[model samples]
Target: MSRSALKLRSWPLTILYYLLPFAALRPLARVGWRPTSRVAIYKSVPTRLLSRAWGRLNQVELPTWLRKPVYSLYIWTFGVNMKEAAVEDLHQYRNLSEFFRRKLKPQARPVCDSHCVISPADGKILHFGRVKNCEVEQVKGVTYSLESFLGPQTWTENLPISKTSFQDQLVTKEGNELYHCVIYLAPGDYHCFHSPTDWKVFHRRHFPGSLMSVNPGVARWIKELFCYNERVVLTGGWQHGFFSLTAVGATNVGSIRIYFDRDLQTNSPRYSKGSHNDMSYVTNNNQDGIVMRKGEQLGEFNLGSTIVLIFEAPKDFTFNLKAGQKIHFGEAVGSL
Candidate 1:
C-alpha cells in the first residue's frame, strides 16, 4: 500500500486514540477489557502484514514534503512532545521513523544525582521493589519468576545453583534494600530511554514475544507481560553488581533501537524462532563495550513503550517510591 493510503487508514485510529483520554467512561470501559492478551486474533494476520510492509517503507527515501506529514501523524498518534525534543520543527525530521525516535535537548533532562539511579525516561512508575530470589511481583498478589523474566539460559548462566530454589526466598527478602521499577511511557512522553546508572554495555539480548498493549490494565492481566513481550534486554555490571534494563515493544510499535550497539540492528534477523514470532538475539560484541554514565541515552522505542529495570541479588539501594507515582527523566529512582 502507498504511504497516502496508510495515512488514510491511520486517521480514524488517530482520532479514536485522542478521544480515549478524554472519555468520561475510560475507567469503566477498560474494566471489561484485557489489553494484554486481548489480541484481535483475526486482525493479527493483516497487522503483521502491514507491519512488514511499513518496515520496508521505513527504509525508503522520500521528499521532505511527503515525509513531514507522515512523521507528524506518528508524533500525534504517540503524543510526542516536540518542545521537549532537540529538534523544534516537525518538518526538520526527514522521515516518520526519525521523528518517532527523536532526541531531547542536552539540558531538557538532567541526571538527578551523580550517585543515584535516575529514571530512564519520562513515564509513570508501574511498580518498584526487590526481586526476592527469582520472583518479582507482576501485580497485587501476582508474582512471576525472575527466571522466566530473564529466560532459562540467562537464569542459568547468570544465577547458577540458585536457579531451582530461587523463588522460595521471596518472603525473607521483602525489604527496602532490593529494588525493581517499571516505567510506562505514554504517547505524549519522551520516547528516548537513558541509562539509570553508570555501567558498561557488555551484552544485549532481544526476546521475541507478543505485541499486546502495555497499558496498566493490560499489565495487570498479562502474567509475565514484560517477559513475554518483544524486548531488548541490556545487561551490564554496575558498581553494586549486575543490572539490566528491558525496552518492551507494544501493539503497532514496530521496532526498538539501541544507541550503543550496532550489532542488534545490522546482523540479527528481525524475527525469532519460536511460537511467539517475536525477535531475539544479542547485539555484536566486536566493538569495545560502550560504558554509559548515569542518565546517558541507552536506546529508544520507536513509539510509546514500557521499560523494566532489574537488579541482581545483594541489592544495596533504596528508592523513595510508591505505587502509581509519576516519574520524569533524571528523577531520583534510587540511591546506592
Candidate 2:
C-alpha cells in the first residue's frame, strides 16, 4: 500500500480511541487542550493495552518472505542504515525490540577514554548545561527541579533529607553547581543507552507517573515534562562527584528494562491498578555498588523515550555538546 493510503486508513482507529475513552473519565468537558490537561486524559486511558499489542506484534515469528516487506518498510520510513547495526541482515531480528537494541561492532563506536564524559545514547541532545539553584532547563522558558527530578524530595517514605544533602556526596564544587543533560530517543534511533562516565550506581528510584508523549512538540509546551513522566532514576558517584541518570517513559513505550536490575519493571498493571502516585526503590548500601565503565550499556527503552543526566563535576569540567545536537553513543560530550 502507498504511504498516503496507509495514513488514510489509520484515522478510524484514532477516532474510536479518542471518543470512547472520554466516557470513562466522566464530565470530560472540564479538560482543556492544554498540554498537561491533555496528558492527564492521555494517561487516564489504559494505553498499556496498546503497548502490549505492539509488543506482541513485534515478537511474532514470521516467515522469511513475510519479514522482508515489514522490515523494508520500517527501514525506509526510519532511514535506518543497516551498515551500522551489528546484525546487518533484516532476518536476524526476531522482534522490533531486538532490532531497536541491536549492538554495534566494537569499532563502530569507540568509547572515549580521556578524563571526560561521553554521550550515553544515540539521539538528539535536547539541552545540556549547568544545574543552577536546583533547576535545569527543559526548554526555553521551562525548567524542572533537579532535586525533584532525581527523586530525593518526592521519595518521602523511602528517603529522608537530614542535615546532609544528597548532592553533597556527588558534587564537591564551590558554588553547589551540578551539570545536567537531556537526550531524547526518537522512533528511528537506537534504543539502548550507555553510561556517560565511569561510576558506581548505589541506588535507583522508579517513579510512576503519566506516560505522556516526550516528543519535542509535547515537551516544549508541557510543564515539568521529565518530572511528570514515569521514570527510573539511577544514583551513584564517580571519582569526581555524584551523578544521576533518569530514564523517562512515554506513551506506548511500556518497558524500561534495566540490565543491572532485572527486577525493575515499568508500566506494570499493578502500579496502574488504582493510582499512578506509587514508587519503587532499591539500594546497595551494603555493597560497593555496580561499577560501570564509560559507554557501558545501562538500559534500554522498548520504544523511544528520554534520558536526563545530572551530575556535579570537579572544577574545570565542561560539556562539548550544544542544544539540539545529534550525538552517538560513546562520543565524548564533555571533558574534565
Best by TM-score: 2
lDDT of 2 at 92: 81
Estimate the TM-score of every prediction. Answer: 0.73, 0.81
Flag regions of model 1 displaced more than 4 Å: 1-50, 54-80, 139-142, 153-164, 167-178, 265-289, 313-316
lDDT of 1 by residue, 241-317 (tens): 56678788765555787875665541123555332322223246533356788887777876677888876434566
206-324 in candidate 2: lDDT tens per residue?
A: 87665766777667766787887788888766776567788998766768888888778777665642233323333445455688888888889876789888887765778888888
Q: What is the lDDT of candidate 2?
A: 0.71
The alpha-carbon deviation from the true structure for residue 293 of candidate 1, after best TM-score superposition, in angstroms, is 1.3
Candidate lDDT values, in order: 0.63, 0.71
Q: What does candidate 2 score on TM?
A: 0.81
Q: Give Cα distance to truth, residue 166, candidate 1, Å.
A: 4.0
